[model samples]
Target: MPSSDDVYSQLKDCVSEITKIPRGEITLNDSLSGDYGYKDGPSRRSFAISLERCFKKHGMTIPKKLDRDKMEEAKKLKNVRDIVFTAFGV
Candidate 1:
């Protein structure tokens, strides 16, 4: 299994690709939109969907609850680290 840090790195890349925000500019203190430049709901949804796809690609089976959990965190994650924790439990 990939370590949380690995997962975090992949997530950073994924978020960068989805949001068109530079990975170096995205801080752990940054919210997905307020800090990372997500323009709207569809953009945010794209990020979440990419995350689910990445997790699946890495051989992680997302529990159905985690889908709802991700959506909840989608609104509430205070920072990038929260997204990492929400996804990978680190």
Candidate 2:
């Protein structure tokens, strides 16, 4: 199993791809929109879908509850770390 740090790294990489922000410049606490350019609900929703795929690609499984439509469930994940923790545990 991958460690939490590895998971975080994967997530960071994905966000970097989407936002073009350097991974080193992003912190786990940075909000998806406020900080990293996921500026709206649709984008966040898309991100959630991409995240599900990302986890799958890495042989991980994101719980269904955390992956909800329109980002309803994921909205509470106000930052990168919160998303990872909610998906994989902290």
Candidate 3:
């Protein structure tokens, strides 16, 4: 199995590609809204979808509630490390 670090790195790469954010620009402290500017509902929803897709690619799944919440909770999901920790339980 891939280490947590490796999984996080892959997630970061996927997020960078999906969001069009540079890999170096993303960090464990960055937020989806405050840092990445995913302010609108549509943008947030798209972000949530992208995150789900990334998790699926890694053989993980987040709660369906994430979708129902309009991805509002995802705003708290700062950085790649948080994403990996949440999805993989690492």
TM-score for all models, in order of appearance:
0.58, 0.63, 0.61
Steric clashes per prediction: 0, 0, 0
Candidate numbers sorted by TM-score from highest down: 2, 3, 1
Mind giving the per-residue lDDT tens digits that candidate 2 earns over 1-90? 557777777777766766788878866567665674667777777777777777777677765544444363343334535655666766
Q: Rate the local accuracy (lDDT) of all candidates.
A: 0.58, 0.64, 0.65
Per lDDT, what order, best first?
A: 3, 2, 1
Residue runs of model 2 more than 4 Å from their true location after superposition? 58-65, 69-78
| Clashing residue pairs for model 2 | none
Candidate 3 Cα errors over 4 Å, as ranges: 40-42, 55-71, 76-83
TM-score: which is higher, 1 or 2? 2
Model 2 TM-score on a 0 to 1 scale: 0.63
State the TM-score for model 3: 0.61
lDDT, candidate 3, residue 62? 48
Score candidate 3 by lDDT: 0.65
lDDT of 1 at 67: 48
Position 38, candidate 2: lDDT: 66
